[model samples]
Structure formats: C-alpha cells, structure tokens
Target: MAEEFRLRSVAVAVYGPAALFGLAEGAMLPVVALSAIDRGATTPVAALIGALLGIGALATNIPAGILATRVGERKSMLLAAAVSAVGLVLCLVNIGTGPGALVLYGAGVLLIGAASAVYSLARQSYLTESVPLHMRARALSTLGGTMRVGLFLGPFAGAAVMQFWGQSGAYYLSLAAVLAAGVVVYRVPDLETTAEHRAAAAAITTWGMIKRKWRVYATLGVGILLLSGIRQTRQTVVPLWAAHLGLSPTASSLIYGFAGAIDALVFYPAGKVMDRHGRRWVAVPSAFVLGASFVLMPLTHGAVLLAVVAMVMGFGNGVGSGIVMTLGADVSPAVGRPTHIGVWNELADVGSGLGPLLLAGVTALAGLGFGIVVSGLVGFAAAGALWTWIPRPSRGLRPAAVRGPPP
Candidate 1:
C-alpha cells in the first residue's frame, strides 16, 4: 500500500492562498448584492448581478484549466489574484457613480467571478497531481475546510470594515486579501513543473481530454451537476424560508451561521470517512439528508423547527464538503487532470447557476414551499444517480478503477 501521506509545506502553500482568496470572496459576496441595490438596481436586477458571478465563472472554467496547462499553476493563481484585485478596484470606483454604475458593478463582479474560476481550477488541479490516491480525500477535504472557515469568518470581517468605512471598505478589504494571497502564491515553488504534470499538460488538448472521457463526464458529471444545483438551491431557499417565516433578521442570521459552523466542523471527519470507506459512503448520505431537509423545510412553521431543518441541511452539506472535487480527481487522468477538472468544474458552475433560476421559476409558478420541494426532488435524484455511477474501486487498490488515462 502507498504509505500514508503526511501534510507537507507544499500542501500548506497551496491551501493558504485558497483560504485567503475565499475569505476575500466571502466578504465581497454579500456586499456586492447590497451595493448593486444601493446603486438603484431593482431587486431582480440586483439578484441578477449576484447570479452573474456564477455565470461568469462558468464562462471561464474551461479556459482557466487550459491556461494552467500553459502558464503553470503558480503563475495562473497569481494572475487570478491580480485580476480579482483589479475587479475589486472597479467595483469600488463605480459605486454610485451615475446611471451606469450598476452596469459597471455587474461587469466588475463578472471579472471577479472569472478570476475565481481560474484560481479554483488551478488549485484543484495541483492538489490532484500532488496528493496520493489513498489520502486524496483528506487533503482535498481539508482544502474545503479552509475555505469554509474563510466563508464563516469573512462576513464578520467585512461587517467590521463596513461599519467604519461603508460598502467600498468591504471591497477594499477583499482587494487587500487578494493581494496578500498573490504574495503567498508567489513564494511557493513551481511544483507544477514536475515531469508528470508537464506530460499531462502535453498529453491532450482540453477538448481531446473531454472526448476521451466522455462517458464519465456525461454520467458521473451529470450526477455531480445535480448535486451542485441542489447545494446552491439550499443556500438560496433556506434564506427565503427564514424570510417566509417572518423570523427576525438576527435570528435568521444566527441560524444560518450556526448551520454553517456545523458544516465546517464536519469536513475533516467527512474526509476521513470517505478515505476509509469509499466516496459513496459520504455521497449517498449527504444527498439523502440534504434532500430530506428541503422536504422538511415547508412542513415546519416555527423558529425552532426551521432551525432544526437548517442544521440538518448543514450536516448534509458538510459531509460532502470536497466530494465533487474528490470525485473529479479520482476519475481524471493524472497527466491531463487539470483539463478534465476544468470540465468537471464547469458542470458544477452550471448547476450552481441553474439551481437559483429553477427555484425562482418554480416558486413563481407554484409556491415557495413547492419550489423548495422541487430542489429536494433534485437532491434525491442526484443521490440515486451517484449511488449507481460512482465506481467501486477495490479495497487493495483505491482509485484503481479510474487509474488509466482516458481513451
């Protein structure tokens, strides 16, 4: 058996920037929507600006992967941070400038989204190459854990900055974080220059990689896509559900915050479980539990019950913290892993964008409760798909079923 992988300086180097980047992202996410509204956008338009973040990410996912191949992971990450910093500056400058301020804001948000896509794909690709199969789950999940911590901490930090300096201050905070992240990435060794990574980069074009692994991409990718959609829907519907309940804003924030903490706390254990048993062990339960939470959302009318459901959702989400990325790593050929990951991430981005839109449409036609139920249905459907599709690698040879390069 491969010796147990230990955390190394390199791993820390990769994760540090990701965590900082996520912190900046968390600070900006809430502020951007509010800023758009302040600049005179309608509620729907403001929401669209938020949605554009995911949409812009989706547009760039493929190219980002390819760029990593050409420029190397470290450089790609540095570029991403730099681009995001520029975007943040634009966001601050355009705030309340004029009638075109909202448009400028949307453009800035879109640039940040694209930069984020570049950073995520590059980092995930690096982890897949650097970590061994036996310990891939733990390593990647820890990556998720770091980001969750940032997400949990960022809002409070942003709120503190805004309290003194206003919305533009939050943007400035994000810019500072991104710049710091760039510095961290700059100091890391050029790990992506290893022969194996280089061969993988040269093995096939991104399009060629897709053609070779079309089946895995089509089947497992679709399942993960649904899971991604369900995940995003939970984020959206849960807040709406709280509003529907007429719960105090403070109470709602606390519930979500508590649930987020639950989600972050479980990531390490979830990774351990996946590594010890198999991906399905966590994947199946996560989908079912989260799906059940959505179904239970409308049935409960009180604050306590709503919180319970929310916690359940958090538990489900936590268990699958890095699952989608882990699964991508398992199936992708090491040599061309980055290219395949790009495709995988694109599906996830699609799902993220699709979920809110689906909920909005369903809620518009039916009711909010039913819209949530529809999300629940998607979750259950994803569970069924994952159970059938995730390959069962032999105990002696973890990740074995997915080892060979794509045809």
Candidate 2:
C-alpha cells in the first residue's frame, strides 16, 4: 500500500509556501488597483497589472518545463518558490503609482504565476504517478483543496496587513511569505523519472510529445483558456466594480473567501458527476451555470446575493479546474510529464492573464455589465465547443460515462 501520509506529507510541506504566496497576492489586489487609482492610472493601466503578470508567466512556463524534465520535479518547485520570493520582495519597493506600480505588480504576479504553473504541473504529475487511478480525482480534489485553504485565509491576511502596515508593509509581509515558500520548495524530495525512462524520452523532445498528443492536449488547453478567462474577469473586474459601488475591503475579501470555501466543498461531488456522466454533459451546462452567474452580476446588490453567486460560480470552477488537472495528469505519460502539463497550463495561464485586461478594457469603455456579459458569452462558447469541437471521449480520464446529470 502507498504510505498513508505520502501525498498529505508532501502537500503539507509545500502548503505553507503555496499559502504564503497567496497571502501576499491577497495584499496585491487592493494595493495594486487602489494605488494605481491614487497615481491616476487609466482603466487599461490599472488592468495591466494582470496583463504584465501574465506576460511574465507566459515567458517562463516552457523553460520551466524543460528544466523540470531535466533536473527533477522538486528542484523546479524550489526554483519557482525562490523566483517568487525575490519578485515579491521587489514589489515592496513602492515603484510609484502609475505604470511603475503596474510593472512591479505585474512582475510579482508573473513570477508567482510562472513558478506556480511549473510547481503545479510537477506536483500533479507526481501525484498521478504516486497514487491509484481510482483515487486520482479525489486526490486532485483534496490536494487542490489543501492549497485553497491558504487562499481562503490569504485575502484576510492581506487586508489585515494593509489595514495596519500600509501597502508597503503589506508587500513586505508578502515578501516574507515568498521566502518561506522558497524554503519549502527546496526541501521537497526530488521526483525524477528513472534513467531508463529518461533514456527512452531522450529521443523525444517536449515538442514531440505535443505533436503526438495534439488532440487531447488541444482540447484541454482550449477548455482551460475559456474557463480561466471567465474566472479572471470574475476575480479582477467584478471585485473592482463592487468596490467602486462602495463595498468594504473586508466584505470583498469575505466574498472571495466564501467562494474559495464553497469551491473546495463542491469539488469532489462535481468530479464524481463528471466521472459518472460525460465531460461534455458535465461541462456544457455547468458552463451555462457559470455564464448565467456572471450575467447576473448586475442583479446582485447585497451580501446574500453575492454569497449565492459566489457559491454557484465557485462550484462550477471547482469542478472544471479539478477535471482539467486530473484529465491532464491522466493524459501525460510519465516519460514526458512536464511537457504535457506545460502545454496544458500554458493555454489556461495565458487566457487567465488576458481575462483581466479584457474585462478592464470593457469596464473602461462601457461598464462592469458589458464585461460580465462578454465573459459569459465566452464561457458559453467553451461549453458549446465541448458539445461540438471536442472529441467524444476524454483520453485516460473517467471510466465509461454514466447517463444522467451529476448527482
């Protein structure tokens, strides 16, 4: 039998670094946006914080994947942690309020995003190798949930630090978290593929793997891009609009916290539904639910309505994210694991990055309602693609599809 604590142990060790980075990120939203406003950032400049971060992260994923394949999983995680640490510390420098602030914020988010993509690809691949297939989805759900616990706590931590320490102090505290993350990344055990496997893969570059698994990889990548775009708008633009409507920081954070909480709660049930039913069946309507939730954003005027939306959106995202990770892990062979995951994440990461920029643009041009509606349509298209463009069976994931809607 696998060691009882194996996944949990590794997860715990890395959990702090993952969670700490989030706490720092939590501070980032308020500090970045409000600070930009203070410095007179136009809507596009304000939105660029996310755009730049995406750009930075997009630059690193392929390289990180290459390194992870050559060096080992644990080592890549370490590098990611260390890079994130330095970037967060640099963010403490206050870099003016307009473009400078956006640049600094982008750099920090980019480092975090790039490292996180590698960190996650490695971790998920390792988990797939380590665990039984029957337990795989649950494992992904639990492990993913473990990190969200940190995210749930992080915004509050950021808000608290910002409340007392001011924005600079908040970044400083976030810097500390990055340092802690680096330590954990360095300590996690190496998960290198065996020499025999490496030798077999020697003939196959990362590009080779992508060329081989283009269909499944493309489907997952495209799906993730669409889903992530929707989420980015929800997280970045919607909050700013709500805040503009005079919502308190604490209330906003709490709403996010609630989403994170409900996300974890709903993950497994959604997974079982996906497993028992069809990917398209599970994905299409859930996409509709997700789209409808955003389209209804304008109708939300209070904590209760916000909470309701949060739960619905969170549940949809939890299911979708869990399915994709598990599906990617399922498709990625042990020989070229990082390559498969890199492509998988690269698409989603870029889409997520573009999302805030697009939403911010819409908000600048029209209003939050236009952005929300556009995002909804994007998600709806993704869902429709599942019915039309995506192939009949998702490779290596879920057993035979069950007939009905999820339980």
Residue 59 lDDT in candidate 2:
74
Candidate 2: misplaced stretches above 4 Å? 2-9, 13-17, 34-46, 94-110, 240-257, 271-285, 299-307, 354-371, 387-407
Summed over model 2, clashes come to: 1
Each candidate structure's TM-score, on Cα atoms with residue i matched to residue i, is: 0.93, 0.80
Candidate 1, after superposition: displacement of residue 228 in Å?
A: 0.3
> For model 1, where is the 10-residue window of minimal lDDT?
398-407
Task: Encode model 1's per-residue lDDT on 252-309: one tens digit a residue.
Answer: 9988988898988999899999999999999989999989999999998978999889
- Tell me the lDDT of candidate 2: 0.65
Prediction 2 TM-score vs. true: 0.80
TM-score, candidate number 1: 0.93
Best by lDDT: 1
Candidate 2, 1-407: lDDT as tens digits: 33355445545554455556566565564566555555557776666654555666677767766776777666767777777677666555565666666666556666766766666766666566555555555666656665665566665677677777776666677677767777776665555345886666455676887889888756666776787777666666446646765788878877776777777566556656654564565567667778887777767888778777877888777666455666666566656667777777777777787776777687779987787778778778767665664444444444321111111
